[model samples]
Target: MSTATARSNLGNTIAAHAILITWTVIALFPVFVILINSLKTRKAIFREPLALPNAESFSLVGYQTVAKQGDFFLYFQNSMIVTVVSLTFILLFGAMAAFALSEYRFRGNSLMGLYLALGIMIPIRIGTVAILEMMVATGLVNTLTALILVYTAQGLPLAVFILSEFMRQVSEDLKNAGRIDGLSEYAIFFRLVLPLVRPAMATVAVFNMIPIWNDLWFPLILAPGEETKTLTLGSQVFIGQFVTDWNAVLSALSLAILPALVLYLIFSRQLIRGITSGAVK
Candidate 1:
C-alpha cells in the first residue's frame, strides 16, 4: 500500500511538471519567434521567418531604426512608470480592501464583496467615453497619472477577489496573538498579514502587469502625447498606411517584451506557489 501511494505521488508530480513545461513553451513560442526574427535582416525575416539568424543574415538595422526613428527609451520609461505605479496602487489598496472584507464581519459585508466583484464582470472599456470625459474635465488627459489611475481601477476587482481568498487562509490565531502583543491594527496588517500573502500579491502583480504594460487603448485615448506614449503606443509609429517597417516593428516588440519577461522571471516562483497553493497537496 505504501509503495503504491509513493509511486502515485511521484507520477503526479512528474505529470504536473510536464504540464507546466509544455504550457510555458506554448506561451513563449510566439515571443521566441519575434525575438529571433528581430535579429535578422528584413529580407531574411520574409524568406525564413522561423529559421535562426545565420552569419550572413544577422543584422542590427532593426534595432538601429528603433533607436533613430522614435524616443524608444522615453516610451519604455513611460511604460515602466505606469506599470509599476499602477501595480503598487492595485496591490496596496486591493490588499487592504481584501483584508477588511475577509477579516471583518459587518452588515452588508457580502453585498460589499459582491459590489467589488461586479467590476470584474463589467467591462471597463464600456465606460471609455465617460472615463475620457472625466479625465478631460480633470485635466488628467495626456498624463501618466491618467493611465495609472485607469489601470488601478481596472485591476482592483480581480486583485481584491484573489487576495481576499488568500487573506482568509491566513491564521486567525496568528493575528490575534499580534493584537495581544499590543500591536496596532495597522502593524498587524502590514507586518503580519501582508507577509503571509506575499505570494498572492506577487500573483496579482504579474497578472495585472502584462495588461497594463501592453494596453494600447487607454494610452492612445487618454495619454497619446509624445511625452506620455507607452511602449505599445510608440511602437505604432513603425507601422504606416501602406509601408510598415517590419524590422523596426519586430525590434520594438522584442524590446518591449524584455522587461515583462524579466519581471515574470523575478516573481515566477511566488506566482507558481500562489497559483498552486492548495491544488497539489
Candidate 2:
C-alpha cells in the first residue's frame, strides 16, 4: 500500500460508485414520473406530466378508483402468495439440485448441469401451450397453485445456475470437516453450505422477485379467476381497449412498484456481493 497505489484504488472505487448512481437514476426515472403523476389530477397529469403536483393539481382520484373498483387487497394477497411460495420452492429445490451438481462426482454430472442450464438459454414461454395443457389436465387452472408451479419452473433454471457456481466456491475442507464431525449430508447442506451462499441466495431471490411480481402473461392465461388474479392482472380493470384510465393505471403501477423496490433495497448489499463475488478475488 504505497500512497500512489492507495490513491488509485480510491479513484477506481469512486468511479464505480458514480456509474452505479447514474444507472440507478436512469432506471428509476420512469417510476418517479409515474408516482408523481398518480397524485395529480387527470388534467394536471397530461398538462404537467413531468412537473410536481401542486395544491390545485393534487388529487386522489386514481387511488380512490383503485380502492372502489376492484378487490385490490385480494389481488395483492394473491400476488404475495404466489411470489413468496414460488421463491421458497425455487430457493429450496434449486439449492438442493445445485448442491448435488457441484458437490458430487457422479456420472453424467456435466450433462445434467448442462441440461438444467439449458433452461436459462431457452424461454419458458415457448412451452406455454404445453404447460397450459398440463395444468388443465391436472385441474390446477385458475388457482394460485397453478401460478406457483409456473413461476417456480420459470425461476429454477437461473437459480440453479447461479447457486451452483457459488456452491462450488465453498471450501471443500470445511465440508470434509463437517462430514467427519458426524454431520449428515442434509445437515451439512442446510447448516453449512446454505449459510455460506446467503449472498447468492439473496441475489437469486431479487432476480426472480421482480418478474414474478410484475408478470401478467401466466396469470392471465393460467389463473384469470377473480380470486386468483394477481395485482398486475387485476389492474386491468382500469385499462380499456379504446379508453384507458391513466390515473388509475399510474396509481396501480406506483403501488405495484413498492414491494419490488423494498425487496431490492433489503437485499441490495448481498445482491451486489453475490454478483461480484469471484470477479475481484
Candidate-wise lDDT, in order: 0.89, 0.88
> Per-residue lDDT tens digits of candidate 2, residues 180-248?
999999999999999999888888987788899989899989999888999888877445421378888
Q: Compared with the true structure, what per-residue lDDT tens digits does model 1 show for residues 1-281?
A: 99999999999999999999999999989999999999999899999999999998999898998788778899989999999999999999999999999999999999999999999989899999999999999999999999999999999999999999889999999999999999998998999999999878888887788889889899989999989999888877544411477788788888888877897789788768766775212
CA RMSD per model (angstroms): 4.7, 4.6
Candidate 1 stretches greater than 4 Å from native: 1-30, 46-50, 278-281
Model 1 backbone overlap count: 0
Give the lowest summed-lDDT range of ten residues in model 2: 235-244
Q: Quote model 1's TM-score.
A: 0.83
